[model samples]
Target: MDLGTCDDSGLETGSDAFLALRIRIETHIATIGIIGLGYVGLPLAQAIVERGYPVLGLDVDTTKVETLNRGETYIRHITAETVAAMGATGRFSATVDFDRLAECDLILICVPTPLNRYREPDLSYVEETTRAIAARLRRGQLIVLESTTYPGTTAQLMAPILEAGGLRSGSDFFLAYSPEREDPGNPQYSTAAIPKVVGGEGPEALELARLFYASIVAQAIPVSSSATAEAVKLTENIFRAVNIALVNELKVIYDAMGIDVWEVIDAAKTKPFGFMPFYPGPGLGGHCIPIDPFYLTWKAREFEINTRFIELAGEVNTRMPHWVVERLALALDQRLGRGLSRARVLLLGMAYKKNVGDLRESPSLRLMEMMEGRGAHVDYHDPYIPEVMRTREHPSLAGRRSIAWNLASIAEYDAVLIATDHDGLDYEGMVGAAKLVVDTRNVCARHGVSGANVVKA
Candidate 1:
């Protein structure tokens, strides 16, 4: 176990293709290709470039590629200066060109793997990306899938597609699965600092994957197999989803009993032992919590087993938007003497989480859609999202632009619903101005705007 006694004896002997790929990796001269210049891939590319490794980014979106190539960042948290600095290093470039995929020595897939309408695993992005790699596959190159998916995805789906180039996987080429740990808008954690989990199908693939992530992150945790690595990511997300759902349900129960859930949580969290505080909201937000747990549920069905906790959590979380609107109806009627039918509701914060513009599966959108359906006029204000687009998932609420909020604008609304508590905003002013504030986030409670003016949903 001595650090000085560590050697390369763990790496298995393989073909010339494997040996040359290993040499390039160990020498730090290998070009890194990142498919998908997204929240995950962009940070990873920046980290590699900072480490003195040249990186090429490939994406299907021409606009994103052009923006990155122009040294501008479309994401809010990432600055243009950082991107321009990386571009100036002459080691970073983003493109829509798949033909240039052959130029890189190691490739990483960081695309989205969302669930379809039936709530099944829609791995279209991973499938399409692997096929593109298959077409351009060559010897002496290593590929890694960093997309979060179900177990056996790297070996069952990607390995065969990558082997279609007349090259056997783990022999002529290396393939591995390493889950991405990118937490957007978190100032404390970055891609370069977070620990990585790496696993592979063979000994050679495992060693290469472990070493590759070791260069990027603070520590690389090597698992027994590729499927276990994938499962580890799922377990991390499912824990959050279930715990959040429990708190959301308790928020409802505590309200019914005339006890403040926020105050209860404040008291419970003070113990600081065998307890972790998970706050309630209108619903679950972000790409991981609301969607990723279902991947395990779908995969578990193959063994004729049902994931009851995941299903129950999903049901409870999904009911939050409707329950929130129902509570808003009661609060609005009690304050203004009218139902939701002509209520002018203003929603605060549209992003799934605070301070990040990512709206994937954001429950605030569902709250807006529900309010609008009930004969209420809904408008939103998010410092992050300037305008909502017509995505295939939530196209009904498209083309809505964020309205600037102030004392005058706040008084005009019949009610204000605090969806996400983005910091640095004047919460005191909004709580003081709005007549009946239905706070789904507990921002008002913390700000001391209580009594007849605010109702904690």
Candidate 2:
């Protein structure tokens, strides 16, 4: 219990304390491994290596492994230089091998926690990865679940599978849940700057997990239990989902009242306190915000309690894509003297957000599919994403093509729908050229686009 420190002489001290201290020090210096080198994992691995920890990045994608091994980054926000530097220092490496999990003392799971067609939490990736980790489970190794999930996932689902390898939690090994708070394209917060929330099964597990995150992160917030930590992540996304639904609802109301929602928001934002702005868009996109909230809602149903706000928000946000199509149809009817059918509709951007190339759950795709379904000949233009895989929803659209930025050609489209507002997009030229514009984002309004040509949603 003394936990003795190393003396200047480096000799054995009080009782068996020196031996115990040596074991602890050895474990502290053990290798760190990260699974899934996407937006969440790559930054975390880089931050861990920057903290002078030997880190291994494991991904099922061979291309990702190849890219990382060559000191390159496939992700837009992550740079090749960082990977190169880490590789040069011999502290970081990536592989597709599952067997290498045995070499890592601390393993962080950052795999995708996507929802299935039924909107049920698809935890297959987490389960398979847990099985892989359990295969290599060793005494004293620490495992942290970084993937977002329902409240009891770490304890009820992952904990048992991890313990299957003849290891007991808090005794033979440590397990914790620290959801990844990755905000891609944010200039202010890097992986190291974000305060990590960690909670383990018990006191010993919690302290060890706290120490592990504290080695790299700015701060570690230790919660009561793993379920609380999981709930914290869900609460963050659910808050956004509900607030975004509020703004989306407001956008509908303001549009009906002939009041510019963006203008109203800009005016409201002038107040310093008691107000934080959440913009209305075509719909919710990206991996986290649109999906994580539903995981909690799904779990909440088992308690026979309804999550009205969460469901309402999801309903409102989901309807926006259809509403965007309606706006486009109306814009075309007024300008071209016809319905949306055979109207050459060109979508502005395909990526979920403004600048990033991530397209998971992108509402732009849904809008395009809905437009195509309504007999509008739809084409998309995203500089970041040149080709999009055809989904079951949009099977007729074989693939997507990037729209040429030429004013003459861009003007050919009957209506241009701005789904995403990328920074480099020529908003002025687009508004000037396009005969009819449906701006789901407030890009056209911000650029002072005139009436008769532009419509805001």
Candidate 3:
């Protein structure tokens, strides 16, 4: 018989061939467990469950667990029907139990990595989750981090924590970094439709992650290392931050020149190539665009390299709230012949972006806080968010109502500041009613209300 031909008796005797078969078995049919059932994790858990895999979602928030158990979705994009269907199928559930993590063959950590008061990268949540995962670390399990953070976090910080449990990465347990790309209120891209980027510490970890993500995501792009995958997410956000800063800066320049920035952009956008439009707003907000790039800037300090562009972008963006307030003050002075002090100013729309109730890092909050500091009697009207959040920085203002689109309330305020251009708000009616309007969002131009009464920033 030829040497290449394997006899049935010889195959049974070969021990090396049996090891390969075991590896194949370990790679397939893995139960997925997603930690942190927030915007990113909950949808991912639902998507995995929809793929016919049993998924366990873990969160420390008892209220979120109760909501999930009752088939309710707190996030805007996620539907209650989807959660109910997943729950009815018995394929998805959430708990605060960390010990049960070992039951899952694949564990995805989707915890929040927020910034501290000093604008520094705060990895406390990530570290706490790592310790919890380490407690129940097991062999043959794939662990992937899906949080937006700086490069080398997965391999340098998280890998050591996982290894502390006496399991070797790439040999016993697999480790990878795959950032979450969740854009709330975007109808075009769903959780399953967005392309995922994955990288790992080694070849085995990389292959396993790619295969697993391929099963759920439409496409998976693998990079050279876990650090690159982390960098990719930062790069995407940093690009946006820089572009937004550019437009915000241009908004100030165009306003001085008595030219509408929105009109200039609309005219320039006619060119099909070399220009992708990034609009000017009151300021930048959301979890990723305003926070993620700073993580990179913080990490770059270790190498003694200054991320000047990112630093400048952050400075410009941070100054936008003050700029908007200054513009409002100017508008009030021009119209009512008085200072911002004792002037009744009303802010429209508190949520950062249009059509979403998420107010995390919203510029509107900062703008309102700055107005309050300037002695302006600030009252905001956001139909989506009834009560304004009371943080240590901004004390809760009592007796504020969502100002109905009435001509009386519009005329009462010295100047109305349009912070967020939500679709539900009546832009035309507000323009018609208000004595003076400082449109920071450029929403006034959309309604063809461009005259001396409206000021575009």
Candidate 4:
């Protein structure tokens, strides 16, 4: 850990630094430091630790550091046993201190790249994390960015800050970008199973990054530049956002013609080659689909080009929560002889997606706010999320806990709205208990529990 000598036992400097680092990485002796210890970084740390490399996790959040140090986890899909196993390896540790970053041979930034209030790209987290890295920049160390952002972020924004320390990138130190593709609760694709698309500032940096990732993941695809790799991540998420908007628009149009959109989609997907099925939901949720596409939208404006298709998709998706509330009101008037105003409504599933406790940018929060704005008393139930944590978008809804699941609890509401279709819910019993069921996800029909009382939005 000494920084004074030019030997392998100490820190390498001059022309031979990159070679020393390469040898350390190839031999699985380099200590990898991950900046964020949330969903992406924790799983990534586990993958590297499994490959016989020591990991040092650095985060500003003391709670996350403490939790991981104690062999516990805050994420639902990543079990406590996984965390305990990481600790058992004696190769994994988390800390809130930034000074310890210099001890690592390679540093990976996995922080959030969220949108601001205007829906523009807010790179504050990335910028701040980069400045911190620049302060402790050292030779023979490689820095890789895994957060999703617009093109040119790695070279245009990060390179200058790092070089200000008098060390040249791709020579004195190393820099690369490899967008994270972590999917929470997905059993089919673990962190190691997903292939990585990595791009570096130069050939040396790219080679180092490719070699580092190849040791852990299934495959490592090396691109020409960092911007191209950044665009790859945006393109993947934007494709989903646009297609989801298409199905959402179709759902609204088909409902007017008394057609089941899900059934139509099921039939259309049989075409095999041309058609790909994208389901209609109450709204878009999660970290990527709802926010990542807009990073490109904001960036495109800089080039004087308009992304009309992407913008329209955003509009269509955002309007879904309001349309769902309107359907609930109409269903109540026609079936129960009552209005949405002063009605007791139960919203099922508080998480963004089913079977996971991630609630970032969840449409369910917007739905609850809209329903409550219409004078409806709202409560929710999610087996994954027991209590609503404080979110920047929905601060007032904090401290609200999920209601108990039972026949008596279900019968108390005037209507039950299925916002998220988590599996293993007693759909048939719910249909029998509630006076009305407004299903946005068509879970009741999918479960073969349908009646005149159940309505699809």
Candidate 5:
């Protein structure tokens, strides 16, 4: 939690480059360029455009660019109306061109930082994006990375690549790291409502980034350096990963003891203090919790340190899909007197979380793979995700469409598994129609839609 001070007083009076950029920022005349028009970048572009700043959106995906330009939305939470409104404002437009990088006074990189096949940090997206920006690099442009990664990524990896064109970071062009905190499908926290953490290569870069973000978000928290800011993002996700892993493990132990883990959590969270409840699930999902902690674990090896605790948490979380499948198997055998082999299984909810269409690193994919590997037939139902897209990990699952939601369709399946507890789902109908229901999310209990056939996994 290296939250540096947020005062930007005398920093306004610096060299000519700094003063010019400061004036542009103060007047809201600076052109803001946002790369990666996916979950994180699109909403940020909307926020900036709403605040009277001209925004130039950049993305390599032509489909996303075309969708945004047509005033349509690919994400569920961000509506087409929002995109149309942005288009109507005449301040927002999207493109797939990297040459337009020089036109933006402040560029924010929101690219992906996924893990490699060996579970190591894969910074190819960040590296390629930096190279793209460096080729079109110019003076008076403030470059900030919003992608989540390990510490020293901005300074060690990006700064050298950016400065390879014979330009100093603090003097010729500003550089900073500000992690994007975008929680999709959460109405409580929007892009403008959340506080941003900014760390810079130098004081001037820090001040510029802090002031720029302060204009769009509720608050801009400054840290000491870019690595500190990078660590802030990792620390936030790692804390969640560890806590979620703890609960997932507890769920297994309690299930064996005939205790309801969800009920235990419900009672434990009643305490006013010293308790912050983190619910268990089939496994950790989304782009952050399941993957971000390993970035730290990989980086620690550089210092001859093993992140045993974090690694253990990851192991616990990763095994959850398998655990869930085993529970489903047992429930199927006990209730229907049939094993998973040749059984028709219906999986509810395909998105990582409830009500959102984002399918990045969803644990449901693992569940499907394991069940299918065990010779069970699987069909999924997700209101948000109509069909599975081609993912790097699960290409074979692509083009798989969700089954129709109805009692007739559900009753046809030999067993049903509730992976994500999305709101407004017909849980009562599911409990009534399905012969055997394995509840991984405790959704049936939460909805008061329990039956003898429902087993809490």
Candidate 6:
């Protein structure tokens, strides 16, 4: 929590090279530069600053740079106070300028590797950031990519860019790949607490990278190569994506059998040894689960490996919103004998996760669209998100605004859909007011709701 600030690298990284760099790193004289000051990079800067290392932050976004310069933060989890405190020390600064790359001893790339419209790996940010660093590439500097991407990206994409500056990777400079493991809105873990997995281009590079992460985080695990490290991230996310898909598929199966998936999960979780429960929801949401698995799927094609599970998981996950809409229609028919066609539906949360405003891959948006397609009048109420912003993923949702929550307003909706289980909402009031309630996240069950009044999807 205490990110002490210190700027300026010590005696020449050129003098006795690796030995001098190692000494500076050990003595806190090494400066750390981070590119892409988004969710991952900003928090990382906080941790590095806390470790008493001077931090130079770079981002192409001018607004983020201005906000940081004004001693503020735009991300929800990272407070403005943290940025102000760091900025006050004069060592921490975020700028759009990439020319400052030559001033640091070590630079970490945490740029986004979002998928294109075709769901292929879009390494534009990574490629652009690497190319920028290469333009200012200097000897005796360590470059590590913390961006989540397809396996071999560090070696195949970024390494060549850095080496293009006529500086040999291992001998003249250092290169490594460290996958970023950041769970936004998780109060239990932070950048410094999460164990970092690092793999370098060479043994010396590995040692240097491990030492750097080890200096800030609780642990730094070294893998065989950068590809393995990249694969490690994709593997973790794919396991989550596939398992969530399995649970969602089972949710449909259990629903037909008149069994509650949540109840079944609770019962199965008691055995404790073989089962790790991933709750069925409206659909898979969040930046990582919905997207990271695809990086592997795209890469696997190069090896002639068919990732059927990944494809199937994505299919099941995508089908959930429509299925949930069908569930709503059936629930209404069973309860008030009214069809969803022309029925007023109020969706409860818009965020991908509870208490977070991030709407990336959030099923609620898809649920809204699907419900509308089914002739239901859909309006959403998310306490976390009050305004609808135009997103690259869902531009259709633009101009929509959150409705005010009240008993009278709640009663106007024929059915209420619980998409995200965010805490502190008046669900009791919602259930009492709405004629029919459809819960996708099992939030109603947790709130002691049951009987013919509520339907679990």
**What TM-score fits each model?**
0.97, 0.93, 0.91, 0.96, 0.98, 0.94
What local lDDT score does residue 435 receive in model 5, on the 0 to 100 scale? 90
- True-structure RMSD, every candidate: 2.9, 3.7, 4.4, 3.9, 3.3, 5.1
Error of 2 at 145 (Å): 0.5
Residue 57's C-alpha lDDT in candidate 1?
Answer: 96
Per-residue accuracy of model 5 over 1-457 as CA lDDT, tens digit each: 2234333475534456766898899999999999998899999999999999999999988999999999999999999999999999999999998899999999999999999999999999999999999999998899999999999999999999999999889888999999999999999999999999999999999989999999999999999999999999999999999999999999989888999999999999999999999999998889988889999999999999999999999999999998999999888888889989979999998999999998999999989989999999999999999999999999999999998899988999999988988998889988899999988888898888879999887
Candidate 4 clash pair list: none
Which parts of model 1 are misplaced by more than 4 Å?
A: 1-7
- Tell me the deviation in Å of residue 125 in model 1: 0.9
* Cα lDDT tens digits for candidate 2, 13-48: 332422332355345566888999998999999898
If both were scored by TM-score, which would come out higher, candidate 2 or candidate 3? 2
**Candidate 1, residues 296-376: lDDT per residue as tens digits?**
999999999999989999999999999999999998888899889999999999999899988888998899989989999
lDDT of 4 by residue, 1-457 (tens): 3434464433243446777788999999999999998889988999999999999999999999999999999998888999999999999999988999899999999999988889999999999999999998899899999999999999999999999989999779999999999998889999999999999998778888999999999999999999999999999999999999999999999999999999999899999798899999999999899998899999999999999999999999999999999999999998888889979999999988888998889999999999999999999999999999999889999999999898888898999999999998999999999999999998888888888899898
452, model 1: CA deviation in Å? 2.8
Clashes of each: 0, 0, 0, 0, 0, 1
Per-residue accuracy of model 6 over 1-457 as CA lDDT, tens digit each: 1224322332123334455567778998899999989888999999999899999999888998999999987787888899999988877988788888999999999887888999999999889888899999887899999988888998998888889868898768889999999998898998899999999998767878988999999999999999999999998999999999999999999888988889899999999699998899988887788899889888989999999879999999989988988888988887878888879988999998998878878888888888887788889998878877787877889878889888898887788989999988877877888888888888877988664678888
List ranges where model 2 is wrong by over 4 Å.
1-28, 389-398
Residue 431 C-alpha lDDT in model 2? 83
Pairs that clash in candidate 2: none
Number of the top-ranking candidate, with TM-score as the measure: 5
| Steric clash count of candidate 3 | 0
In model 4, what lDDT does residue 415 have?
Answer: 96
Q: Each prediction's Cα lDDT score?
A: 0.89, 0.84, 0.83, 0.93, 0.92, 0.87
